[model samples]
Target: MDTVADRVKHLRKQLKLTQTTLGQCAGGISKQAVSQWERGITEPQWEALNALQRACGVNPYWLLHGTAPMLESEHTPSADATPVGPSPPGHPGTCPLAELLDDLSRRLAAADPAVRDEVTRLVLRYLENPPAGARIAKAIELLLGEDENLPPA
Candidate 1:
């Protein structure tokens, strides 16, 4: 990627995460914040970059400097041992919610922009102040339609 904005957008796409999902992965940042980063309107703060590193195994150095090896695992130290961050839980080197978020992102990709925006806002709200489990299930059903593949609520 030529710029930090390009890198951020590429990383988000590589992770198959929507802007909202990526923001959530990066410590509950807003979708608008992610958008601004991708659009080169603003750069990510150090804390957000660190959270992205933890959330998605991004090499923070490469992310900022456009160096080689986009992923943390691909980098090798020439001198002192680099401090390693903890692997994300659920699956090795991945955000716990990645799969669910990817699926949701794909499902919403073809949605009307306004509809998608509204859903994203609702999701962010629910995340901030979570509702009952049944309420969450109902909201998902209402937004994405019933899916036989979804497990029992």
Candidate 2:
């Protein structure tokens, strides 16, 4: 997972935004301060983080941890269903996140650009749903905990 600093840097590059421009989007946050945040010399305050999220049109959580794809075009999953509670009882799935990611990878690996978009929409739909109940929830939580390098929320 990319840290917040890494994500911020990536976002700036992709958007062709200078520190000055990013600070402007962040509501008067100074260019020097933005540079510091990007360089990992300092962290942004919660308000500043939110401002950056709004400016970049990204989920604050995802921006911090790089858990999800950077663009809507990169998501994948099934249509008409977010991630439900879990796979059926006999289904050997461990983590829904893992399964979803694997499925997306397989589909994307096989798909042409023309048909890949619908897959992206499906992933976005499932990204919003948290796991249900302790059985799956605990496993997912512990799995996430293993990601200690993920940027702090």
TM-score of each candidate structure, all chains considered together: 0.51, 0.45
Residue 9's lDDT in candidate 1? 94
lDDT of 2 at 132: 34
- lDDT by residue (50-133, candidate 2, tens digit) is 466555654444665566667434555446433433443456534444343443455455565644555454434334344333
The lDDT leader among the candidates is 1
Model 1 Cα lDDT, one tens digit per residue, 1-153: 799899989989988999999999787999999999999999775456557767788766567767558887786565454322222233354232334455556667767787677667655444434334235535654777644454544
State candidate 2's TM-score.
Answer: 0.45
Candidate 2: which stretches are off by over 4 Å? 71-153
RMSD of 1: 12.3
